[model samples]
Target: MTDDVLLVHGGTPISGEIRVRGAKNLVPKAMVAALLGSAPSRLRNVPDIRDVRVVRGLLQLHGVTVHSGEEPGELVMDPSRVERANVTDIDAHAGSSRIPILLCGPLLHRLGHAFIPGLGGCDIGGRPVDFHFDVLRKFGATIDKREDGQYLTAPQRLRGCKIQLPYPSVGSTEQVLLTAVLAEGVTELSNAAVEPEIEDLICVLQKMGAIISVDTDRTIRVTGVDRLNGYTHRALPDRLEAASWASAALATGGSVYVRGASQREMMTFLNTFRKVGGEFEVDEDGIRFWHPGGPLKAIALETDVHPGFQTDWQQPLVVALTQASGLSIVHETVYESRLGFTSALNQMGGHIQLYRECLGGTPCRFGQRNFLHSAVVSGPTKLEAADLVIPDLRGGFSYLIAALAAQGTSRVHGIDLINRGYENFEEKLVSLGARVERPSAS
Candidate 1:
């Protein structure tokens, strides 16, 4: 795969308006959930991304008819004519993304069987699928491990049951929705993840005629229905991507208008932005982000669920914190190994120290041992571009922003990883007037 990308000289501040599209987090899940409809489903404002393409290909493999206009990223899926699905090919991408595993319920409900390839996400910690399996099993699905892949079969009709997740994992919570929506009765899932994407999925499903209720206390109640018809709804704009660019505005001492960005979904991030001396204004079209053209003050930041600072937004924001003038303490409660990227930043002359104790919020998964799950960043140091590799989604974004803000040119490898989430990121870079090139691998 061609994974090499280069970022040339910075010093030039990005001064333009960028229009944000649909949320990458919501589009793919909505696509997979479309399968549960068993009819034609139309998704509006879908962003063009690799993961979305992968999900599309998998759905087409199962005999679903998918169509869209040449230019509009909108999608339409007609699942009535689902053809032959090559599960082997789908499995090849299992290690590529985490969303593939959530397909088990819809595939089983439609085809009576499911063959999952594998799953991958941020390498922050052991993101297990045990919770997903337990929920599916509770719904009367039989799961089996095979030499080639994992198979899930529903020998009898799935009956609703109470499912309690050990952690409010986004993936597990989605699996519950996918499995329980069609199970024989009402399913109550407590300790559910309240991420915006989850809510968006519920919203789309509701439009498709599914019975669901959301409580303020993070409990989701889904009443199983015998059938779900196709739906046409617009996907939400991506909050994580919006937050990344907001960080870029902070790190580079620049102002940018992130068109279509909604402040309502990012209240926690907006509050933290103000605390860091970043100024923002929300208009009808989008949000504008800028630093006050002075030293950014460091503040305590913690990663949490929706209505809190998002864990996925942590990496890109960390780069901004490195530009802050004082010690910016960050407690990453979602993933322990997430702080590993700090060492790479340190190599580039950033002052960051990691720790085990939660420096800012409620204790989380990594509260002890050598798991440096928190970071103390001291900065305003000049950054010089160096050879770097893209580690994960948000980290890749931070590295690019750093390159764009640094002096020398930067060569970043494994750039294809960013395509999994960010839609047309390279094009967006050029739109922002960045000097970036993706050289074909030798």
Candidate 2:
């Protein structure tokens, strides 16, 4: 494997404008939802990322014709000729993404049986596929585990049933939504994840003639439909990407105008940014975030499912918190090993301490599980450049932020991994006046 590396010259503020497209989280799922339709679906505002490419390849392997639309970032997917793919071709995508698990539902509906290869994603925590299989099993699908992968067969029509997730897992909720939409009866799901991306998927499905309802108590009810048609809808802006840029601006003491960033979806993050002495202005086009000229204040924060500080936003913001004046406490409730990335920050001259006990407002599932999910960040320390390696998507971006804010140049390895989520990130960084360049192959 070719490991792509970037040389980053530090101490430069990232000041400029960049545009964010459809959410990385929502776009891929929307692409998968097209398999449930009888006709072609048009998805606008799609970001060109590795995950999208992975899904597109998988869809094409299933005989779905995917082509670019007239407009930029638009995808036209026709699933009328969907067919079973070669097992070896399907296994080639194994360990590349977790999207294959989602294909089981739509594939099971179209074809009698579906084969799922080994799934892989960011090594953040234990994101088990048990929630997915359990929901499928409740819908009357039989799964057989083999050495290569899991094979699922639907002898009869799938019937929707009631399900309550142990946690508000975004993936499991999506599984329930995708499977329940085509089942025989109504599916009532409690303790569901109500993230904006999930709601957007629901909207996409609704446009495709599916009946779904959401309640204030995190409950969702979906009545299965016999048939679904194609949908033409523009996806929501990527709030997670917007927040990453916002955090980059705050960390480097610069200003950035993120076009296509919606304030409604990022209200919680904006509030937390202001609390940390970051300035922002929201208008019709997008939101402009900058570090106000002052010592950044420290605050306590926690990660929760929807309407709370997002776990994805925690890593980049932690880089900014390292520049704050005092102690900043962060509790990561979503992923157990999410805070482990801070050790690299400590290597870069930031003082951050990890703890097993919850350090923020609420105690979480990881509190008593011996997981180091909490952090104490002491800031106002001068950050110096160090040799850094990209960990995961969010953690990799955090390392970039740290490198840009530090005093000297740093070499960042495995930067190709960032393309899985962020689209054209290196170009965007350069546009923001960040001194980043790929070293010539020696």
Candidate 3:
């Protein structure tokens, strides 16, 4: 047994309280936004996750002085020395994260050139960087693809332009926002992703003296400024992490209070959870979720952009749906290969079937594309423990939920992958009374 393996004794309900700090998606981007400023910026409610560490390292490498603030989960960053820094060993970050690519605009603004190493993220689909490069090109940055990485140069001051995204992608939208804030002139972005995290990022940029506005019709306009100061802002709680815990409580027939969870961002997920026979109560501090002692109802769910079912919430909820009374249909419109993790669930006695055609929702990009992006889960089946391998961040959490809801002992490998998003999850599991142990140490 290796250090990454966990032994889980199943049939235990996960009960207790766990606090979620800043969002994994938003915090890193906020850190990256600090590079656009001249003075030190303070970010509160930051989570201690692997992605945060990765971004912090990248920032430090770029000559940004990052240090702990007075409070826990607070970071103060100074980007004054960024222009004088000589970046080396950048390829060491290659295949580690996709974040390095987002550094192009800020680097190019400070220093006329930037080098982006090979990017790597979850193997869910062909998450190409075309949208990013295209947006940068529209902002007057030239990109040269090399064998090891991509080199970008801005011959002059970047000027903003009009951009209409082919899809309302979160990453592409973020790239445009980060790049457009410092560019010259006005930038109009149509069909932008308006996720709460993105809105928070916009707020961060606004505090730093950037001119940006969001219209009702999924459009955003950013007017570039000559200089920007620092900002003091608190990040929003992790709604995706909160939903995962809610699904865990439902799957294990337990109750959990997720402290720091906000209700505004989770209204859609809460409605769907209620429809599935789950119960939840909202308070000022956080939200409490439970199974509510009944047969879980089956429902059709479709993953989409903001104001729709989130793609990140689908995997963990699918584990809970296996206890539903009938068939549950899931249409994945976000990532083409997201449903591939269902094969591991079926290995553990789940009756989930995958299909190439979209079943419960309108045809999406993956429909008729030969990708198994749809799933039919026939549930009320007893789940037995089996050896499992963690696939991705969300899928790894789902496997942990499944193991806790199963009937026997199970071995879970690659649990460290969960640290990329979840903060101190093993400690949280223990606090929730889960019977998990390091196999080698145990």
Candidate 4:
């Protein structure tokens, strides 16, 4: 049942409002950055999700003092007691998320060693750590892969240097941030992923006294600082999670108000939502999106790193796209085999077909390989509840929305998969008036 999820009966249009918690993209790294700070750092508006719990466990294993802060989603980590790290418990986090790899640089700098468990994210592509290792090598860390996990060590003083990435990977870029902050000299990162999460993480580091700057394009420049003090920061709310809920509104023909969601961070998604006949209002607290009337329109969507249509939004939007009047073209450029999951959607009475050749009018990962890069969803398809398996993070949310929009109850296993990125999701569902409940696996 590692990947099984259970979603209950279909419901009418979800009304009322739901608030989002802190960003999953920023919290763990902010916690890791606390080690560089000399004082206790307070993180406000933290989510009580599983990934945050895992990071807290990792920080505790490393001898940091962590506990609830003043606010509801607040977390405080004092790394003053952090001397050495015992990575034995890291195995439990292996296959949980891609975040543990980001701990390597911080651990290596603080304790001269690091043990990284395996990583798991969306099963969309081969998310490799080659760039992470390469950047660490730029800082003079020796990396060795063992049967169980990865062992990293640094002999000399940690020094920063120039490095380039083949792709703009969010996790890899974060690795650079963690390692470079306390490093000896200046580090310039090229081809970096410029997601809003990255911007927020940098803001947290700056509050902790790290001299970092983002130049034109996707390059980041970080000048090494000897020490960083703890800081009090409230992370940005989860943009992807907000988009997921908005997609649920479209899929179920309902309405949802995402409190604390940011419109600037997700402008492209919001534009697409409006284009698909969805309506939303930008307010001080959050954004609201709803399906106006009739079937949605088939539009071309491509997954990019940031400042473009997000890859994380692809699967969830697909459910809404199924209601479009014509064939919707989705080009997954970030992850290669993201199309593989659509076959399961097709099994649910949807008219979705996959293509290995780039069908979105662009050359993609599948152009040369066997990877399916495109999906053609026929319009106004009715989804029937089926036994659903949680493949990954975004896919899991897609299934949840699909199940709620369907006419009948859906027994979806792997409910815990929502914990990876979303905060207080069940409560949010309840607030949105969803008829959801947990049951033992059948």
Checking candidate 3 for backbone clashes, the offending pairs are none
What's the C-alpha lDDT at position 61 in model 4?
82
lDDT of 4 by residue, 382-439 (tens): 8787888778788888888888887788877677887888877778888889898776
Candidate 1: RMSD to truth: 1.7
lDDT of 3 by residue, 147-239 (tens): 877889999999999999888888999999999999999999999999999999999999999999999999999999999899999999999
lDDT-based ranking: 2, 3, 4, 1
C-alpha local distance difference test of each model: 0.83, 0.94, 0.92, 0.83
Please provide, for model 1 over 392-414, each residue's C-alpha lDDT reduced to its tens digit, 9 standing for 90 to 100. Answer: 88888888888877777778877
Q: In model 3, what lDDT does residue 69 have? A: 100
What is the descending TM-score order?
2, 3, 1, 4
TM-score of each: 0.96, 0.99, 0.98, 0.96
RMSD of 4: 1.9
Top TM-score model: 2
lDDT of 2 by residue, 225-276 (tens): 9999999999999999999999999999999999999999999999999999
- Cα displacement (angstroms), candidate 2, residue 301, comes to 0.8
Query: Could you give me the TM-score of model 1 versus the true structure?
Result: 0.96
Better model by TM-score, 1 or 4? 1
